[model samples]
Target: MENTESRNTAFEDIGQRISKAAKASRRSVSDIELVAISKTRTADEIRPLLDRGHRVFGENRVQEAAGKWPELRQDYADVELHLVGQLQSNKAADAVELFDAIHSIDRLSLVKALAKAMDKLDRRIPCFVQVNIGEESQKGGCAIEDTASLISQAQAAGIKVAGLMCVPPSNVSPAPYFALLAKLAKGNGLKGLSMGMSGDFESAIMLGATHIRVGTALFGERSSAG
Candidate 1:
């Protein structure tokens, strides 16, 4: 009970901070969805947040999420799970079945696979096209030049292109990257911008992020899922 109260307190503290940030940005607090990232955290660590009424959560891998969330969701039916990690082409069907939103749709092949999965399973999960905003060779998003075409192709294949997502270059100011992602989303008629993590979520909200994926700030440091 004490632990649950602590969790509730922490969740409310973050919510208040997010609300204040949204107001400062001239956006309604209700408009922003706080996705408490539960990547390496166990369901035991996550349930307190769920008990405190945090319905949205993000995970980095399909297998890890699969290990826990099914049982958690069985208890809390209102949970909205998001995939915040890179998705493989072969995992599209499982991803479609598990996640409510996907924030890492980055390539043409994934676009096609997700489309087919959604069609075959009769479930359409919203997807955010991850743009390689920093253009890092080792990252997981599509190149900025290819973003528009990929989104178009995804749309053509009947996948719901929700918006754009990006992880800015580390150790650099993320404002420009967030602003650029917002610009691209607006230009392409997309609305959701899935950016920002623990450190820069306030900046992202200021720059028009409808979905902020926060992990460490809310959950503290995770040891290891294993």
Candidate 2:
């Protein structure tokens, strides 16, 4: 694990990189939100970033976030949580209560479930329609062709469709996928693009991403146990 000073340094470095990317692309750094990916990270590990005043974070599972954030939020009351991984329809109610935003609405069932959960909770949680940019069978996102309908359906159900999110195919250039996501968001009249990670976040910012999900770059490598 990294010491507190080292962790702060890493956070500063990522902020600087984000500024550089935003400036080079002629975009306002303030318009971009950095969601420190906090899945698989323990409370002790996450506290430093919280202490450093990073309020927005992303998690991959509802159960894992439920286990940790409730306690963390008691202390850092302003923290915002975003769900950034595959979500089962059964967990929709739990997710509606926990996440400030959800970035994995890839199907009609999940959309309907989220709508029902949000209605019951009386919280209209914002959502990102995840698009399968790479078209890989193993990944979790709606088909590109389904993007418009899904966004429209979510909006109709009173879900705040914020934008689109994607995990581009690894070991290749991500610009094309980022560009495609931007195009999809534009076509759908959406703006948020949650599409970056540890290795290629700079490219993501350059290509009009409003939300970049960063993990290892801020928290360092995760152990297998996490």
Candidate 3:
């Protein structure tokens, strides 16, 4: 089928890119994970990618993920679900139950809610802080000014402080921002950095990203699952 072919082509393209980047950077291809972001795509599209051996996925909206995860889990129980969106406090319980990683914790209130949710469910979860390295007011991230303090709060609440995640501002060089995050993560000795996306992933890899939230490049334009 055409969809299957597209998935194959996309996988090959991503593999080629990863190989080239890893070679260029002199880092092992196995070091970095290419999370095939399946935000708006359906099972028809995602199944092919999973069949191709992509076990990690990123979803941008909690609502969308809530609808798709059940079906996706039925087929791929081993799939790792990552919530890469601005998580609302009301959705903390659902997120803790559904996602393997929360890559957008940028507020103290959000962290408190997540901690409570995890405690209530008696499950320890992995999570990351979203830093606004680009300083874009439109984007949802902890302003760089308050990062260390935020981390302390999460730590006190018994939340697993995994790493940091960030979105580079559009229409500009994101390298400096990525570098800043890299330095910050190192300073904190964090274990993960879910930076970069379809457009700026190579740069992200170069700056020591452990995970990339690739959506469009992996699944084509957003599929209206509604």
Candidate 4:
């Protein structure tokens, strides 16, 4: 049972949050789109979110997306799926097929493999180049220094490199990192700046973020793995 009343309440609450944040940031509510990272989330949770008309969905792992997307798509074919986690070369084919847009085209191997997979399928999916702007060793992305070269290489290989993505350091302001990614995108002639998250998305928007991969704030804490 959807329980339309509960769905409406959740939608209104999240919309109000979006409204207040957008006003405070001096941006229009439509300027930012929230991707509900539903990785590791069961359909019982997702169906309600979708029922509320929240169509943007994000997943972290390829296999999890592979498993979940089929059922989700069967039910909610209109929801847009985004891959917001590290992608592996071995799983590139499935990723290429599953995601409408991949926000984590980070490594050279993954990019190359994605190109190959799309080529084999005779398709070209939109992709964002992940930049480890904060340079965290645990983070998976091409460094800011390597982003331009990677984007050029991907474009040459027939992959459409649309923009830059990054994760800012925790406990520090994310504005600089978001701004840097925006500058990098403009300097390199890229269009999308995929930065920020549940915590720092406002900072990201202030710095010209076109895409914010929000998770916890939208769907609560996700499971350890998706």
The candidate, 1 or 2, that scores higher on lDDT is 2
Q: On lDDT, who's better, 1 or 3?
A: 1
lDDT of each: 0.92, 0.94, 0.86, 0.82
Residue lDDT tens for model 2, 158-217: 989999999999999999999999999999899899988999999999999999999999
Model 1 global lDDT (CA atoms, 0 to 1): 0.92
Q: Estimate each model's TM-score.
A: 0.96, 0.98, 0.95, 0.90
Clashes of 2: 0
Q: Worst lDDT window (10 residues) for model 2?
A: 1-10
The candidate maximizing TM-score is: 2
- Give model 3's TM-score versus the native structure: 0.95
Could you tell me the lDDT of residue 142 within candidate 2? 93
Worst 10 residues of 3 by lDDT: 217-226
Query: 103, model 1: CA deviation in Å?
Result: 0.8
User: Candidate 2 clashing pairs?
Assistant: none
Instruction: For model 2, state the Cα shift of residue 89 in Å.
Output: 0.7
lDDT of each residue in 67-155, candidate 4, tens digit only: 77788788788988999898888989988888889988887788789989998988788899999989999988898889889999888
Candidate 3's residue-wise lDDT over 1-116, tens digit each? 98689879988998788778878888888888888888768778788888887899888788898888788789788999888888999999999988988989999999999999
Per-model root-mean-square deviation over C-alphas: 1.3, 1.0, 1.6, 2.5
Question: What C-alpha lDDT, on a 0 to 100 scale, does residue 165 get in candidate 3?
Answer: 91
